[model samples]
Target: MLIKSSKQVSRWRTPKRFPVSRNSGASPASRIEPGVSWPEPEGATRVQRFKVYRHDPESGKNPRIDTYAIDRDKCGPMLLDALIKIKNEIDPTLTFRRSCREGVCGSCAMNIDGTNWLACIRSLDEISEPSTVYPLNNMDVIKDLVGDQTHVLAQYQSITPWLRSKTPAPAGHERLQSPEERKRLDGDYECILCFCCTAGCPSHWWNGDRFLGPAILLQAHRWLVDSRDEATGERLDELEDPFKLYRCHTILNCTRTCPKGLNPGKKIAEIKLMIQQRRS
Candidate 1:
């Protein structure tokens, strides 16, 4: 190929650049300085402030709290709705788990304003001040609002929550229980394994290595009290260790913070009572 001279190369034209509009579809309020209150959008009547914890291990920076201003009138009444609005409209990088926007899934469980709760069920009106949101306490945070629940789930699995009977069920029939016997499972059976109670317990915070936290212990009690189960003795044997069962000091934090409002403290006490009766 023939080489172009300096005059020929200098005459070549470059592509034209267009000026971008300052007021584009993107919201300028999204890039506002941290800790500053975001301005209310046009036609928005109410603005709710939220301070959420943010962390990314790969960023090699210290964790921080991010402030977000949500238009209350445009969003749903629940805290989870505000979170979703932030993730979708304001900051796409915001991360949190949510499903079944109702309370049944327990996926949106987090610490809000110093209490562990399911965000989907918690009304935004309940928070009088600027709400603070965080991941569940005493658990490793995987990212913004997502916590690592591997240990808590492992402890739950150790309890053998399914029915265990020495004798198999009758051919082609499931195990049956009387209505009175079924009533025994009312408080215990409702647990959704959210681990909110476990994360809230001081005993688990201190002795999580060995102690089965309130959630797992409550699940253990569920199996122990099952009318169709025949492994009470074996289950009790597994939970007899001092750290495994007796570490609970009855601070009632578990009971106070359970999002489901089930009494895990009472269930743990019942387990202790059963063990005491067996020994006596």
Candidate 2:
């Protein structure tokens, strides 16, 4: 959920400086330690443990997992609720992105329990063990759970995601599509651009600078299949590069890790087939 107060938003925007620890040189696992233990409220039962990644680049200390004990009885059911509790009551310095707690915003995507997930929608009850939360893998961490998305956002813009048509609208009316034509956009249009699939893909981990990855590729295909769009040839030309579209090896990690359950692997394959068909 978005920070409710302007003051809270200001506090979240400013990264608090943490004192550098003597164990800065120790490995992250070796430095695993418990943080402040909030006292349970009266009648509160069932404490939940969270091993959260903490890092403040301005502090000059290495990243470490700080364990926090949360009173589940006092917290909400979702994992994001625990995080909010931690920030509000336990430690304000702890940082993460969240908005539209309903999971539509896609701002709360992070690495949870060795997989990328939207923390706002994932339930705390779903985690049987002490939950581990970290920034999305293979991206520069902005602070703690926030990953620098400059490259990914740039790649998304590179594809020109919006529809393009040479034909003008008839009599000032909007472009129209048949029901069957609109049905073609079902799976593709559901993508919220969370980048979970991209972060989970081994190919993106290795060649993210060039591959465009599954999330962006899926968006490209979304436009490619839009009946109202008329730039299919130009979109295909932009995605025809070896590293751009051919890097996907059908590993299906993108499909497996997608929080939205859309099949990026299949969309990517369709792009390749279209390229080949055009060449032939």
Candidate 3:
């Protein structure tokens, strides 16, 4: 085959018409950015070590901890800040899930300093000891610091996680809740489903499939206690199985490890009480 000239090939390969969208015309339409990163933080003299767990299922290798150095002054105070810095500057391959860096999203749950917490909230400067971060323990890692949230998410979906009331409210208004009725949802509403409570649970780790676990049980109580929602019996029916609800052996790890200060154990105890009362 005859080869084309260099100029002909270059003209043939270069894109000619980049049709711009009307909405995105004012903004840069191209998603690709140059391989550029911020230089090491200025005025940041102190360096802190982060032992981050690294894994790649595609590589066919065992997991290992990779050390990364971060300039304390250069990074934000939270552990997530440092992790993001590492990902953005040092290694773009480093991966973890994070949203709403204020800890409200619960997406950054991981084992930091031997405790389960939302990395966005855990302050790096608060702990004087050296730090090691791992994905939520006992979870199958899809990548570094990303646990398979399917189990907890499936259990959460099993709860249906919404009001299932059949009773219709007045024509012009929605179902109104009283102060007392709304108070019942206080502790349960705070759960962000970051998997910290379930991940910290030893019983959950052992029987995660059978056990509904703390986070699911917590949502169960959220509905069971809602006075405005008239689905208590159904909620209890969904959770009354011996393995599903009773497996929470009051280990209290769910409460102790909850970053939101909500007691999932106590709320679980409340669900047990509801089941017992229904039987009585």
Which pairs of residues have clashing backbones in candidate 1?
none
Clashing residue pairs in all predictions, respectively, total 0, 0, 0
Best of the two (1, 2) by lDDT: 2
Quality of model 3 by C-alpha lDDT = 0.78
Candidate 2 C-alpha lDDT tens digits along 90-149: 789999988899878888999877678889988887764476787887788778898899
Judging by lDDT, tell me the better candidate of 2 and 3.
Answer: 2
Off by over 4 Å in 3: 1-45
Quick one: how many clashes does candidate 2 have? 0
Instruction: Rank the candidate models, highest lDDT first.
Output: 2, 1, 3
lDDT of 3 by residue, 85-119 (tens): 99988999899999899979999999876668888
Misplaced by over 4 Å in model 2 are: 1-45
The per-residue C-alpha lDDT of model 2 at residue 133 equals: 87
Instruction: Please identify model 1 stretches exceeding 4 Å from their true place.
Output: 1-45
Query: Model 1 lDDT vs. the true structure?
Result: 0.81
Residue 18, candidate 1: C-alpha displacement in angstroms: 56
